[model samples]
Target: MEISVKDLTKKYKDKYALDHVSFSILEPKIYGLLGRNGAGKTTFMEILAGHILATSGEITINNENPFDNQHLIESICLIKEGNNFKRDLSIKNVLCIYSMFYPTWDPDLAEELVKIYGLDKKAKVKTLSKGMESALGIIVGLSSKAPITIFDEPYIGLDAAARRRFYEILLEEYEKEKRIIIFSTHLIDEVSLLFEEILIIQDGRLILREEADVLRHSTCAVTGSIQQVEAFSKDKKVLNKKELAGMMTAFVYCRKEEAVAEGLKAEGIPVQELMIHLTENKGA
Candidate 1:
């Protein structure tokens, strides 16, 4: 399965949500789509899922346009942040509706997850708590077993234990049958480790996209005397630098061993910190 996005642009009146974005997803690995609010992550996902059309450019799945393609649409499942179901539908009704929509839906898994989440199948959607609704969304996304499953902050009200359980199930299901899973969330620290590839967007542009492993070993935070830090950063790729009193800290895309050997305190840069370093405003 392959998803190709070439010059994908989505415009609204005078503002552009996605501006000439291009990327190809060929692997069945878990991908992390990340950005600050209004950074176009949701816009891109909507376009990819065929929920909305782009203003210009194109996105294709297996060489065919995803928009209005029933076959392709059925192969893609998107569980959004919320409002995934009608207010009057029962939990069982929602499951039944989704099971018929996806070609690869698994009923047993859905039932098991419903029990694991301790949800009453007969409960109406409007009556369920926020956490229960989120769990229902998770169940749909996971049980759909679609070729491309997109989750856009679907755990809005889930507690920590429930969220962790969802992550574990995600990994387990992925290993059982590898498929494309695009996850977007603000809680990056909790699930960053599961991302095989990470894409960071800033203000309707693609700022960075690389394998999470590469990002993990490619950057480090170094702290020491202001002069030493500055000198160390002279020849290296520094993403961000901060100074206070007589000391400086720099985030650099290079090995931390060299900085340690040179008598500076250095540690691996966290993925969340890396994303911030690459996307934060520069006082324009």
Candidate 2:
């Protein structure tokens, strides 16, 4: 399903959780919704999933407003930050209830995911560990087979090994089903390879949206002597820079060809590393 958000804004009295955010999501693509904590990713996802109303502006899925629209809501599934399941219900019962709600729910896939995540179907949700709860959320999010599926920090509290398993299964399912998947995660480097496109939000505003590989290739770090670095960075848009003794290093945003043609080597910097540096370094 194609999603269109036009001038979408969400406010909480004095704060704007989503500040006039607008973007369109083409179907059958995996999008990594990235931002620091309180960047409004969850707010945007909540509005998209129809769980909350936007303070202003609009959102449409297949040209229909999703807010309070059951037909549209049924096609969208969101696994948010907290546990929405009844604590007293067993894992199996929770899955059963979800199956009743979503017409496209795949029982086989849910069962397979439960086994894959090492979740005990008969165990009450209240008894499960944090990691197990996350696993359960992922299982339902993936197996629901909703056209527009959003996972907000779905792997929180999971160990490295379990997180890897979730990523693998997510990729496997996407390859077979070709559905839209929007994931909000702080673990960018670990899961970036799975995203076809990336949307970055900062301070409740959309910073940039582009193809993942293209976005990475569009920015690069150049290191050399202070003179050499400064000379090379003269005309480029530098995202960040640093100086150590007489040496200088700069991370700039420019076309790959232009950087190469300028005799500056452009290397692929991991998104997480780049974000950390960008967030910390303030040199213009």
Candidate 3:
């Protein structure tokens, strides 16, 4: 299930939600789609899920277009943060309807998750709380078992424990059946370890796309006196820097061994910090 996007663009009346974005999802791995607010993450996901069409350019899976393609839509299960179910239907009905929609849906998994989440099948969707609804949405996403599963902040109101359980289940399911999972969320630290690859969008443009393992091994944060930090970071790619009490901390995209040889305190940078440093305002 390879996704190939070539110069994909989505435009509003006056602004571009996605601007000439192009990338390829070539494997069945968990991809972290990261960016700041209004960075076109949702827009790009919606376009890929066949919910909307791009204004210009193209996005295809295995050389087939997604827009208005029912067969293609069934292969992609997109669960948003909210509004994934009908407000008037009961929990059972919602699950039944989705089961019919997705040919690959697993009723046994859905039933098991319902008990684990403590959701009442008889309860109407409108009567459930925000956390309960999130659980239901996650159940649908996992049970669908689509070739391409995209989750866009689908755990909005879930408690810490429930959210943690969801992550566990997600990993279990992925390991059971390796498929393309593009996850878009603000909670990067919690799931950063699960990400096989990372794609960063900023102001509607694709900025950074790299293997997580490579970034984890290469990117470093060096902390030392101002003179030492400055000399070490002079020729390196510094993503971020700060100075406090005559000491400087430079978040750099460089080798850790080099910084360590200089006697500076160096550590691998987290994915959350990498995203922040890469997308931060350079002019400010």
Candidate 4:
């Protein structure tokens, strides 16, 4: 599905959760939806999945509005951090409900993941630990096989090993079948490798949207003597700067070739570093 958002805005009284955001997304690609807390990433995703109405502007999935559209809703899935299932329901019952809702639900895959995550089918959801709850959400998101699947912090309470398992399974599933996967996560460095494109939101506004490779190479850190670093930074968009004694490091948004030609050591900025520097408070 191709998703198009134009001037999308969501307001809560005098406050705006999303401020005139607009973007178009093509299907069968993994997108990293990155932002600080309260940056409207969830609001944007909820609007896209038709769970909430936009106060203004519009969104279309393959040229059709998704709001109250059951045909479109079934094709989209949004698995948030918690409250995905009723606490009193057994694991078996939850899966059965999901199977009924999503026509593409894979029973075999769900069963396999239940065993892998150590969730007994007869056990009530209320008795499961936090990590188990997260694991179940992951199972549903992956097994539903929805064309547009959004996972908002899907591995909240998981240990490192279990998180790695989720990542592995995510990659495995994507390799087998291509679909739109919008993943929101705080572990930028760990999960960045899976993203083909990245969207950055800051203060309820869309700040950056670029291919992962292009973004990594878009900015670089140059380190050298104060004079050399400052000289190299001239006329460039500097994202950050630090000085230690006579040495200086300037992270600038410019081509790698430009930084190297200016007689400074250039290092490609990692996604996590780029995000931090871009979103860091300027006044601080």
**Best prediction by lDDT:** 3
Q: Is candidate 3 or candidate 4 better by TM-score?
A: 3
Q: What lDDT tens digits, residue by residue, belong to model 2 across residues 1-284?
A: 88999999999999999999888987689999888888898989988998899999998998988989999999999997668688999999999999998998999999888988888889999998888898999988988999988999888789999999889988998999899999888889899999999887877788778898887888887767788878888987787777999887688886657667767666667888666665544441
Return the candidate ranking by TM-score, descending. Answer: 3, 1, 4, 2
* Model 4 regions lying over 4 Å from their true place: 281-284
Query: Which candidate, 1 or 2, has the higher lDDT?
Result: 1
- Model 3 per-residue lDDT tens digits across residues 1-284: 88999999999999999999998998899999999999999999999999999999999998999989998999999999999888999999999999999999999999999999999999999999999999999999999999999999999899889999999999999999999999999999999999999999998999999999998988999999999999999997888889999999999878889899999999999999899888895531
Error of model 2, residue 174, in angstroms: 0.3
Q: Which scores greater on lDDT, model 3 or model 4?
A: 3
Q: How well does candidate 3 match the true structure in TM-score terms?
A: 0.98
Q: Say which candidate scores most in TM-score.
A: 3
lDDT of 3 at 215: 86
Task: Report lDDT per candidate.
Answer: 0.92, 0.86, 0.94, 0.91
Tens digit of lDDT per residue, candidate 1, span 156-235? Answer: 88999999999999999999999999999999999999999999988888888999998888889999999999998899
The residue pairs that clash in candidate 1, if any, are none
lDDT of 4 by residue, 26-53 (tens): 7589999998899899999899989899
TM-scores, all models, native as reference: 0.97, 0.94, 0.98, 0.96
Q: After superposition, how far is residue 283 of candidate 4 from its true place, in Å?
A: 11
Q: Which stretches of candidate 3 lie over 4 Å from their true place?
A: 282-284
